[model samples]
Target: MDFEEKPFLRECKDIIEGSFGAYLNLSQQIGDLVNQHAQMVREAVSKLYSLLILTGNHSKPDTGIFMQLLKPLSESIMAIQEFREKNRASSWFNHLSAISESIGALGWVTVSPTPAPFVKEMTDAATFYTNKVLVAYKEKDKTHIDWAKAWLQFLNDLQKYIRVHHTTGLTWNSRGTPATASAGAPSAGGPPPPPPPPPADLFADPMKSGPGGDDTRSALLKELNRGTEITKGLKKITADQQTHKNPALRSSGPAPYKAPSSTSQPVVKSVAPPKPPRFELEGKKWMIEYQSGKRDLTVSDTDMSQSVNIYKCKDCLVVIKGKVNSITVDSCTKLSLVFDDIVSVVEFVNCQNIQAQSMGAVPTVNIEKTDVVEVYLNAKSLTAEIVTAKSSSVNVSVPSANGDFVEHPIPEQFKSIFNGSVFKTEPADKAA
Candidate 1:
């Protein structure tokens, strides 16, 4: 009779509400506006929403369902303008952004038995679609850019919603646990069995077996005495451990350059990493690869005409001193970027524990699959439109009038019931 809205059930409801149906609207004007694959897009959206309404919100949503929906939706969105109509940009962007929200919502819960792979696969999808959206990028057109901003705003809101509400909570799968689980076997990842009993003789039944009763008892006593003596002389017994025990058993260096005998197995060579990092200028893009643990690295003498791409760098600080056309940081860890403004977008993908600061105005910023990102926007770049999808622990700091930085977090925890006419969702912390 204990009904407290079982674990993560509310989160599921919020996700459903906050997403494209009850709590939010998949804007009717979107996707379908484009003549190409519009019906497919709508059908995919309808199917996804219907699935969410039916079972997703009552518990953890299915990752596979969302992914299946994502593929068609992504293909449709990417193809919105293939026949040429800028008006469709808004709808295309809107539909994709909506899917991003759904995907992000799905990630905040345990949808499958394997939580790690579930999150990872979902994250991969997020990154794939989000980055692939670049195929639709048209920087010179203001209207197209505006729609892009709208999409970014929606995505940012979804992220903020998750943070405010589910910081320490995860949506649980209310679905019944699999009956296939072996009840008799120790559950996976459970604690190890207790240490084995003391040797066989310690458990010998003196009266029933293992020699006559008197003899067994006497032998047990003698064994215990020997153990006690050994315990007391532990330091004496181990005294030569450093001088003889280790030297006798272990080799400190190669053994006298002896040739390998026929009995010895041939040494297997170590394999190199697949897809090693790259740093080169291909046309307009400056490629930086696998640079690690450097504090004073610089992309010097660059101007607003050049493009910079950083990949897989770790624990490093990269300073782009010159104004650049665009910058992209991908699959990197703990990387920092302090750079002048770009004429186009700044993008980050599949990265973690990373940050970037814009010293000048930038038109757009896109982030995907990355978590724990900190963005610093100075006064000149305050108007930058940031688009992040399926990312976590993200914050933007802008310079306050007093010359200090004031961090403004998007997607603050808040709630808005979907009204019949339209949904009006407001973030709780965004006003500050």
Candidate 2:
């Protein structure tokens, strides 16, 4: 018989494919718009510089020139904003916001006279957004994830451009002359006087002019290179998807059994062995439990030097004690974890009904694609990434070096999610 595909998986795949296709198209359009804007600015600046050289006017270009250069940037920003509004319900909203912010920074830098700081900011934002996309891709089998990868490449290229071209327009050279002064002869007094030191706040605002600056040509080249790479990756994924087929199941041969010696020996009846108990305890060192005809396991560790890994289990529990080691949980359900002391890392993925308790030194919790129900923690610090929790009740109390438990304010993000329920720790009995 032919293999039948699961409806849910197929539906998910189709949704991902559709979303990804739309994302790819929109991202390409936005990228093209940005590139065009960059190109326009470059040409405008180059032309303006040449004209200044010919006319020997070192003053800033008329406001009309600035307005003209800014038009494309404004339009691109509007387009991105529109895209964000249209896809507000998308799973990629956070990613879209990051990309939009990066593009907005780019727009600001384009119109700014001193764009060095803004360039750096734009690069950082774009790189951050790219990293977020990568994280999403690693967590799910969504097609739009590939678009994120492409977007990142494009952002990296933009970053390169900003770094190479420190400034977008003409600036005073070290000799106090306009950089374009090379087009004319030097003064009779040997060389022109050295340019005065730049103002202390020259870089304070990216929109103002500085004495000297860099250009955008090399950065543009990098952008072009990355764009080509994005196209190639997109095409490859598309082709691979077209060629791939649903998986098929194959049958195994019949089970083997020995024939009884009928003639020589009296027939002995075969009896099936009894199944083991659902729960087993190996002294105080370990315990294992099986439920619902499947293994719902738990592993407890007391040694701080050892690491723990739990995977593909349901209704699982993990207990940790001692100094601290890393713990990783993946593809689990109804998980309950307790950390008694300091831990290097706590990572969870594709999990639900999670309950974690922390006592002593704080550990960073990295949760991805997991839904958390509760977390009770006491530590010096906690870091959560890509973690979603329905409710969090944090009672912060950090033991000082002198052994006094000092209160630390809950992080803003956690407080917001918990709706201000985070507070000072109560007595142990009361907390329970």
Q: Largest TM-score belongs to which candidate?
A: 1
| TM-score, cand. 2 | 0.31
Q: Locate the minimum summed-lDDT window of 10 residues in model 2.
A: 194-203
Please write out the lDDT profile of model 1 over residues 1-432, one tens digit for every residue. Answer: 112243333443344344323212323333244223334333433333333232322343333332332333334333332322333123243335434433433333323333334434444453443443443346443443434344344345444544553454433336633111111212123212122222322112334542245566678888788865757755554655554556764476445667779999889999987666565666656778788787877888676767787877999999987778777787899999998878778889899998899887877788877899999998888888888777877889988889998886656366776889888776665654
**Model 2: which residue pairs collide?**
161-219, 165-215, 166-214, 167-214, 362-379
The C-alpha local distance difference test score for the whole of candidate 1 amounts to 0.54
- Quality of model 2 by C-alpha lDDT: 0.45
Q: What is the Cα-based lDDT of residue 286 in candidate 2?
A: 25
Question: Candidate 2, after superposition: displacement of residue 362 in Å?
Answer: 15
Q: State the lDDT of candidate 2 residue by residue for 1-432, as single tens digits.
A: 101132322332233235423445545454544333333333322232233232232333333333333343355455565665565334444466556656554443334465556645665555544554555445554544666555554444443444444345332223333323223322222212222222222113353332221234445567788865757655344532432342221123334476866677686899996534333332322222223224324444456554555555567566665655555565667777776654455666566777776765544565555654455555334443323322233324445678766654323242223337766533333332
Pairs that clash in candidate 1: 17-23, 160-411, 303-323
Superposed by TM-score, candidate 2 places the C-alpha of residue 48 at a distance from the truth, in angstroms, of 15
lDDT of all predictions: 0.54, 0.45
